[model samples]
Target: MSLRYKSAEESRVVISELMLPSHSNFSGKIHGGYVLSLLDQIAFACASKHSRAYCVTASVDTVDFLNPIEVGELVTMRASINYVGRTSMVVGIRVEAENIQTGIVKHCNSSYFTMVARDDEGKGIEVDGLLLENTTEIKRFLKAVKRIEMKRKRREEFDREDFVPEDYLSDLENYKVKVTCTDEL
Candidate 1:
């Protein structure tokens, strides 16, 4: 069979939901966990649309919450295929919250989810290649590539048998941690 390709627009998914009182946390703001759930849902939708198959989340590579969302606000999430590999795709999501009363919108979070397509038997399957059509799409794809490389390097460095905690101890000197068990470590 010939290889299939798709533009990011073909798989883009956008969802908007009203934040309810039940979605608020102790601080009276929408709980972060609730937002994460919506992000994952959109990511799955986008990936499945792109591959035309069942997809499973391989990882939540990044989630940055820039602003707090409040109850009674309208939360909108936009998801698109940012990068595609043999069997996996990186889904980029942008979240925003709009205060209905004020009509002001705030960027709440930006996230990246890695999803892998699966066949009927649940084995990983090849996904269609991404056709970058514009500069923004190209940039998103490139950023995903860099993020994957950085994550791989971080895992390799920390998982090495010769890894040393002391080597990175000094790197945290400026942080707020006290390191109470430094001697034990």
Candidate 2:
């Protein structure tokens, strides 16, 4: 079978919603969970559009809330395929909030979601590769590749059979926790 390639622009998704009081937390700011839900929705849409198959979120790599979103601001989220594997794609999402009256926009959060396409039988299916058009798209794809590699290395190193907790004790010296298992050690 021939390998299929899709451009990043073909799978891009953008959504805007007005933040309401219902979406706010006790402190009156828009809740982080609400923002995360929007991010997931856009990620799924972008991944599904790229693969033309049902996609499921396998992992969320990073969700850094850089700025607080106000209830009255309009929140816009943009998602596009950053990288694609045989059966999975990494969707990068950027969230920004705009004050309608002031015409000012603030970047609120950025996240990366790993989504895997599945067939009707619920089996993983191969997805189309990304066709990077510009330097920015190329850089995003490379960054996703590096993130995946680093995550794999971290898991392998931490889950090794010969892992020793004591060896990492000194690394936590500046942390707030106090180790109290001296007798057990």
Candidate 3:
């Protein structure tokens, strides 16, 4: 493993796999979880290779299941390291399924996964990052940035739900006690 990494634009597919019957659902269609796991595996490889360290999942911005893949079809999921941060790297993954025998293909899903690179002591480390030499991959890195921002803003907003002011009144009658309990919280 090399510590020098290329920019996001230079990230490329690290690995791929053909979907098998064991990876499908009861309906004989590839299961979303199975596909997700495959995406994670590929992304992990891309991140680990670039960062030259252990990479773990921090978050998945989104995954759109655009189509279905039958058990006999060949599902190819390609993952690329699209962006790098102080402690995190973003990987873009696209999945497509093709009828191996018929030679027909369809886009199945696409997503961005955020990964944290950790040293042997479980501390943060810098990644080699992608070179981002092309327009398409540059766009992907930009998109990953945007996706991360959106998810972050959403998390900030959602965190407010974890607390409620005494006067906010979960129930009108229950709003009486204003006692502060600091230790457990």
Candidate 4:
């Protein structure tokens, strides 16, 4: 079959219910981390659609929470492939939570993620060179490109630091990657 979505087109995934609670925080808003996990899942869907290959989240850039999501809101996650490299693909995912009952829509978060599509041997695979379909898609791609550039710059700035982040310093336990040999294939 042909590819799922055009390069310059917006591929959206809607989440009807993501466990919204009536009252959680003092402000009665859903937790930020909960929303972040949902974004990761939707971004995975976008990457898988583009490459038709299993992918893993390599890195998640800055996530700016512009607004809050109340209970009983329908969180619609719109994601699209923005940039492609040798083995890594960057997807732009915008998550908006709307109150279906009150018809209120608000932007929750906008973030970019890097995904690596791998073959059965757990190696990166080659993805098609997709073409943009319109100006809006092109605009999104450009914005993601800029964000990636900034990521590189920020990495360089932190290169000289000896302190390692807590997550990085933690032991790599239970993070085994499944790999299969060609002979077994």
Candidate 5:
């Protein structure tokens, strides 16, 4: 079978919602959970558009809340396919909040969601490859590749049978934690 290809633009999705008082936290700022739910929804839409199959979020890589969003502001989320593997696509999402009266915008957060395409039988299926048209698209794809490699390395090193916690104890010396183990080596 011939391999299908799709441009990054074809999978882009944008959504805007007005933050309400009901979505606010005790501090009167918009709840982070509500924003995260919107991000996941947009990621799903973009992934499904590109893959043309049912997609599920495999993991959420990075969710850095840069700024606090206030209630009554309009929140906008933009999502696009950053990188594509056989059956997985990394969807990058950028969130911004705008004050309707002041016409000022602030970047709220940025995140990456890894989604896997599945067939009707609930089996993983191959999806279309990405056709990068510009330098920005290429850069995003490379960044996603680097993130995946780093994650794999971390998992391999920490999830091994030969892993020793004492070896990493010195690495945490600058942290705010006290190690209290009764058993001796």
Candidate 6:
């Protein structure tokens, strides 16, 4: 009967774990894929906390690995709902790593996961709107709106009925890639 709203603070989730040797890649740094798994988990927790429903990750909007995390470092991830639609919410996550001995910290990653609330029958369910309490929250919500619009426009531009590969061939000339066309192609 009435619209419901929840604040970003209410949806916040934070977790910290020590990077272990088992989680390291061949080069001895923490694996990005492992970090991604953690990010997805936190996103789900934050979204579910906000909506009070089970949520599934519809898409990973962005993942920027700014720094490599090393084994033996303390990794912390913070997730919060940045935007909320009728059935979906964008969870913003920031990852940081700290060197225990030196007390040095570095930002490891920033990511956004779009999650959709689902019911028992796997149907999409309505979620409460975001309650923006401060300028920071307002900015994040606006940025999410812009990102959605940009993604829509990108899809339309690439999936146009008259799309032609040849038209974009020149666009790739500046890259280091070399294109070879087969007779059948």
CA displacement after TM-score superposition, residue 70 of candidate 3 (Å): 0.6
Candidate 2: residue 98 lDDT (0-100): 99
User: Across residues 100-167, which tens digit of lDDT does each residue of candidate 4 receive?
Assistant: 87787888888888888999999998765557777876786677689888888877856755644443
Better of 2 and 6 by lDDT: 2
lDDT of 6 by residue, 1-185 (tens): 78888889988999999999999999999999999999999999999999899999999999999999999999999999999989999999999999999999999899999999999999999999888999999999999999999999999989998777787888999999888866333
lDDT of 5 by residue, 1-185 (tens): 89989998988999999999999999999999989899899999999999999999999999999999999999999999999999999999999999999999999999999999999998999999999999999999999999999999999999997888888899989999988877553
TM-score of each: 0.94, 0.96, 0.78, 0.74, 0.97, 0.94
| Candidate 3: segments with Cα more than 4 A from true spot | 1-5, 8-11, 161-185
Clashing pairs in model 6, backbone N/Cα/C closer than 3 A: none
Report the alpha-carbon TM-score of model 3 versus the true structure: 0.78
List candidate 1 stretches off by more than 4 Å. Answer: 178-185
Clashing pairs in 4: 8-133
Q: Which candidate model has the greater TM-score, 4 or 6?
A: 6
Residue 172 in candidate 4 has what lDDT? 42
lDDT, candidates in the order shown: 0.96, 0.95, 0.78, 0.73, 0.96, 0.94
- Candidate 3 shows a clash count of 10
Q: Write the per-residue lDDT of candidate 1 for residues 1-185, one digit (tens) a residue.
A: 78999999999999999999999999999999999999999999999999999999999999999999999999999999999999999999999999999999999999999999999999999999999999999999999999999999999999998887888989989999977665545
Q: What are the clash counts of all predictions, listed in order?
A: 0, 0, 10, 1, 0, 0
Model 2: lDDT of residue 52 = 98
lDDT over C-alpha atoms for residue 16 of model 4: 48
What overall lDDT, based on C-alpha atoms, would model 2 receive against the true structure?
Answer: 0.95
The alpha-carbon lDDT assigned to residue 125 of candidate 1 equals 95
**Candidate 2 lDDT tens digits, 1-185:** 89989999999999999999999999999999989888999999999999999999999999999999999999999999999999999999999999999999999999999999999999999999889999999999999999999999999989997788788899889999888876445
Give the Å error, residue 166, model 6. Answer: 3.3
Model 1 vs. true fold: TM: 0.94
For model 4, the stretches where C-alpha displacement exceeds 4 angstroms are: 1-12, 22-27, 157-185
Residue 103 in candidate 5, Cα distance off native in Å? 0.5
